[model samples]
Target: MTTLTLRGLRTASRFQRVQPHPLLGLQSQFLVPQTPSFRYASTTSALPTRTPRTFPVNGPSTTLPAPLNVPARGENQSLVPYLYSVGKSYLAFYKTGVWNIYTNFKLSREVQRKIDAQNASTFSAAVVSASLTRSDLQLLVRNWHDIKRVPMFALVLLICGEFTPLVVIAISSIVPWTCRIPKQVESDRRKLEQRRSASFRELTTEPPTEAGVEKLAKTQLMHINKSLGLSFGMWDWVGGLPTGILRRKVSRRVEYLELDDGLIRKAGGIQHMELEEVKMALVERGVDVLSKGEAQLKGHLNAWLLSREKAPVEKLLLTRPSVWPVRMNAPEKV
Candidate 1:
């Protein structure tokens, strides 16, 4: 039994020696050596380094295109003349007020009704007068009540009304020297004038080429159309009386010339047509022919131009069949 046990033990020891312990072999392969002979070097230090890179930024361009137009000084003239205009308008209003009073006294239905009512009440005239006085007192009380309800608002309005005239006078006196045209407005006005002047120069100096004529005509037409759009009537003038009059007389005149340029372009070249032929041509193109003859054409044309210039493009495009490119391209006349 001892011999068999010894043989088994020896056999086990020989098997263990042949296998050489799998875990011990793995640890020997993987475990880091702590010996000084096994020093580590950094992988990053052996690799080449790169310089820091930068990109350039873009900036706004300094050079700008020159302005196309410059407005005349006359176009942006001082407000001093406007002050005089205001004074004239005030006088006109005062006169109109007096006329209104006279008209009311003579023609008002309310006034007539009052007179009839008083006449009908002849027997109780004294009582009626006393009642009227009492009613006026009541009206005053009601108004006082209203004023007291919004005391702050009433005070502001009273102060404004009391001081308005004095303020206006002060402003007008100071405005002439102190107030200049705003830079933006002045710049815009100058640009407009420059454009108009350029157009005028082209019309006068350049030979009657179709392109030149067409360009001028279009420019003028646009101006005239704009002016007509902005046109105001008598009511607008009357409404604006309390403020500086909002008349566009100067602008209208400029636009009128523009309209004339368009008309002239339509009637062949300026050099091609006689004055009479031009008038006839204008009449043909919806301009009202004055019965008073050629002498009155200017005044008539001005009025007619205002009416004609309104929705000029729409009228041309919609009503005039021959003016259309499709019609123009047709073999037969439209």
Candidate 2:
């Protein structure tokens, strides 16, 4: 009985310790359902995700529109609207002036000094520019006359319409830019017509070339001085402005015009500019815009610009003998 029990125990132990299948230990490496397979990947992708840049260079274009000073107009546009605009313009002008004055006065001493200097420089530039151009000079004169009449005009308004009509009657070319009536415009047209009608049938002028610029400039200086029509014949040879004075003036004028030419050309040339601007340019260059057609005016302006464009020699024109007698330094003896 003991032997049989021991044999039975050994048999049971052998059955429990049976050998395992070869695929059981390598199940992960199988491709088939019942076979072993490789392990799944645990690492992320090799390439990185892309993002946009923080800042870019180009943005947008900035071309400007031309300014248009169009007047009020319609089937029933009346004098009231025009009057309102004039009042608005006057108020704006005064408001700007007062504001500028106030701001300038509030600045520190050093800042005020700088501002004053800047203002003086600007004033000088404006004066020189105005005097060099005819239309600008006319405008300057008109404003001056307007300024002189402003006090009387204010008084008339203060009197409660008592002298308003009388003041209006007295108002002619001396009227402010903001207060010009249709009659004034008509008067200007009439003046232009009369001037055109009375002038010479044909006019000619000598233009300076690159070859003989000095002589031409001198001749031009004398001619310009003569054209100025100063009282008592100040530009005539006998009682004329000294040649030195003429030279100085002409030289400065030429330099100013030359400096402005590039800017004007780049700003689409004088030919297509505002009528007043074109007139200003032509008047300064001795071209008659009056009674001329648009094409003719443009042609003259273009010719004027072309004539001066290549002549940087004008800068040294003052160094030459002006349109007057020059005592050649007695041919200094050797």
Candidate 3:
């Protein structure tokens, strides 16, 4: 019986080594299934588990997201909404009279300064001499049309109390205060138009000779120089107040020296002179002309005429070489 038991124990050990235990197989089937072997990789290390990321409460990521697909303020959108917003805000502050008070103070100070400057005498003397004559009154009447529309009540107040100097000053200070920025913008536009018109007229005038063309070129160069030197003045700063916060548009006007076909024809055709002759003339006048294609020769010449060089003229003259080959005399007949 002992020998038989020993043989049975050895057989059982062998059987355990060859096959998985019944309990392990049942657990695997119920809980975890056996994975199939892959031809490339049968075993792989398990990946690390990822933890949830945390961010600071006060960081920009926590802020409200920007409005996507919304058009920019100036991109052909109606301004009714913006105006309504401004009106709403203004109404909130209407009871404060802050704008009116500030305007009145500024105007009073400005008017006083003007009064003092014009008279250069005692305050009483200035007031006494500042009488509105019949012509002055008529001129004011004519100029009334120039002023922008004001409230009917404001107009009545201005007209009824025209005799009273204090009332006149008050009305003048308040009535046009709101329209000042628009008036200034209009004035600046007019000035720019005038300048452009004058330049155009000057350029259109026919120059008699090449020298005249050179003179015009110099004038244009000078104008460019002046424009480069220009900066935003006090008036520009004041006018910018109305729209500066709403938009960052700059009001600078850039003028270019553009010659029309008529003007070009008047100033002698580009092919009137030989390239060598033109180049020589420009060099003599201390103008640097870089040799380019014949197509760009006209532009170079125009630039040469317009350059404002302070250098003294050089005496260099360019001449084309003779194209004819050396002539050989016929061999003497013997």
**Which candidate ranks first by lDDT, i.e. highest?**
2
Each prediction's TM-score versus the true structure: 0.16, 0.36, 0.17
lDDT of 2 by residue, 1-334 (tens): 0111111111222223434334223221111123111111111332211222111110000000111123455667687787666454433333222222221112112222332344442323433433212222222233333445445555555552422323554444333433443344345445433433332222244345443323554445555544322112323437446666766655545544553554455434543354444554555554455566665555555655554544442422322222212212221111
* Clashes, model 1: 5
- Clashing residue pairs for model 2: 28-37, 29-36, 29-37, 29-38, 30-35, 30-36, 30-37
Position 99, candidate 1: lDDT? 25
lDDT of 1 by residue, 260-317 (tens): 3343333332333333433433432333333345444443333333333443332331
Per-residue lDDT value at 191 in model 3: 48
Tens digits of per-residue lDDT for model 3, 1-334: 0111111111122222433323222111101222211110111232211222111111111011111122235666579865554443333222112222222222222333444466552333332464211112111221232222234324544454322223433333333322222233234334443443444344433322222212333334322222222223333334322333211111111111111111223334344434533443333222233434443544454443332121101101011011111111221111
lDDT-wise, the better of 1 and 2 is: 2
lDDT over C-alpha atoms for residue 327 of model 3: 18
What order do you get sorting by lDDT, best first?
2, 1, 3
Clashes per model (N, Cα, C within 3 A): 5, 7, 0
Error of 3 at 219 (Å): 20
Clashing pairs in 1: 69-191, 70-190, 70-194, 71-190, 71-191
